[model samples]
Target: MPELTLEATSAIAVAFAAVMTVGFAARQQRWGPGLMVVGILGFLGIISFGIVTRL
Candidate 1:
């Protein structure tokens, strides 16, 4: 197995977060899910930023 770099890991995390955000946004009937999506994106952003800074 090959070792994955920080960029690859960050890309996967962002993709997963984007999918969840879309799924939650599609419901359009609850504020909780929407807020969850925002939180997920925010967390991903912070993580990516940290990863980039370390590089």
Candidate 2:
């Protein structure tokens, strides 16, 4: 099993925030649900990464 470093966790959080920001912008612009899907996938990916890193 592996442990996640603080830097890695911070980076992931930053990436998640960026994705959410983009999702919000897209929604405001009426860009359809594609960006929303991407945002959801991004979130899931972050969670998966955390789990994998912890193992």
Candidate 3:
């Protein structure tokens, strides 16, 4: 597996963090399930990216 460039990893990490923040905020505000889905997708995307990169 090739190492991820620092910039690419950071960008993805930042996006993941931002999505998590939105998820928590939405939960606090009693937003519907859609926001939750977005959050989950964001998290899973990061995980998938990591796995694919490592393979």
Best by TM-score: 2
Best-to-worst TM-score order = 2, 3, 1
Candidate 2 residue 48 C-alpha distance from true site, Å:
6.9
Which ten-residue region of model 3 has the weakest summed lDDT? 28-37
Model 2 segments beyond 4 Å from truth?
28-55
User: Model 1, range 1-55, lDDT digits (tens) per residue?
Assistant: 2445778867767776776677577657666577667757767776676677767
Name the lDDT of candidate 1.
Answer: 0.68
Which pairs in model 3 have colliding backbones?
Answer: none
Candidate 2 lDDT (Cα, whole model)?
0.72
Model 3 lDDT, residue 43, Cα: 70
After best superposition, candidate 2 residue 30: deviation in angstroms?
A: 6.4
Report the Cα lDDT for residue 23, model 3.
66
Q: Report residue 16 deviation for candidate 3 (angstroms).
A: 0.2
Q: What are the per-residue Cα lDDT tens digits for candidate 3 across 1-55?
A: 6666879877877876777677677775656445667767877876787789887
Predictions: Cα RMSD each: 5.5, 2.9, 3.2
